[model samples]
Target: MKVCLVGSSGGHLTHLYMLKPFWKEKDRFWVTFEKEDARSLLEGEKMYPCYFPTNRNIKNLIRNTFVAWKVLRKEKPDLIISSGAAVSVPFFYLGKLLGAKLIYIEVFDRIDKPTLSGKMVYPIVDKFIVQWEEEKKVYPKAVNLGSIF
Candidate 1:
C-alpha cells in the first residue's frame, strides 16, 4: 500500500529510517522539514519539505499546515505513518479529514515521559504505536508495539 512517513530530524528520523526498508517494496514517501537527514537515508522516492520550525513551538504549525495542504492534495496516500514533530501535526489533521488512515508512532524520545504532540494526537490517531510500554499509561489506547526499528 502507498504510505507516507512524516517526521522531523534527529531521533524521529532515526527511528523511521529503521522501518524504511520494509516500505521500499511498495510505494512509500517521506515528508520532513528542511533537513538533509532524510535525503541522506532515503533514495528515489517522493518527499515534501515543510517549513522548518525555528522555535519548535506553535508558530511553525501555521507554516506546516500550508505545506501539508499541498502534499495531501498531491500524494493523497492511503495511509500516513508519522514519528513526528510539527510537520506531522498538520498531516495528521489533513489525513483524518481526508479519510486516510493515520498511524502515529510516538517518537522514541519519550521513553520515561510523553511529548505535547503525543498527548494531543494520542486520542485522535487511528492506530497509536508507542516505542515504550510506559507510554500506554499516558495514552491507554495506544498500542505498545515495540519500536518499528
Candidate 2:
C-alpha cells in the first residue's frame, strides 16, 4: 500500500524512521522539515518539506494546511502515519477527509500526559498507538504497543 509518513524533525522523525521494518517494502514518502538531519537521513528518498516553527505558530499551520492539501491530493496515499510534534495536524485532518487510514503513534517519551498532536488526532485516527501502558489512561482507546523505540 502507498503510505505517507509525516512528522516533525529530530526525535519525531527518528521515531518514524525506526518503523522501517513495516514501511521498507511499501511505496512511501516523507513529510518533514528541511533541516540538515532530515536531509541527511532521508537521502535517496522522496520527501516533501513542510513549514516549521509549527508549535503554536498560526502562520506556519496555515501554510502547512495548504501543503497537506497539495501533497495528499498528489500522492493519494492509502495510509498516513505519524509520531509528531505539530506538523502532523494538517495532514491527518485533511487525509481523513480524503479517506486515508490514519495511525498516530504517541511519542515514546510521553508516558503519562498526551502530546498536543496526539490529543488533536486521537479522535479521528484509525489506530492510536501508545508506547507506554500508562499513556492508555490518558488516551482511553489507545492500543498499548509497548515502545516503538
Clashing pairs in 1: none
lDDT of 2 by residue, 40-130 (tens): 9999999999998999999999999999999999999999999997999999999999999999999998998999999999999999999
Provide the TM-score for each candidate, comma-separated. Answer: 0.90, 0.99
Candidate with best TM-score: 2
Query: Stretches of candidate 1 above 4 Å error?
Result: 54-56
Model 1, 50-89: lDDT tens per residue? 7776236667788788778888888888898877776787
* Candidate with the greatest lDDT versus the true structure: 2
Worst 10 residues of 1 by lDDT: 49-58
Candidate 2 total steric clashes: 0
Q: What are the runs in model 2 whose C-alpha is more than 4 Å off? A: none
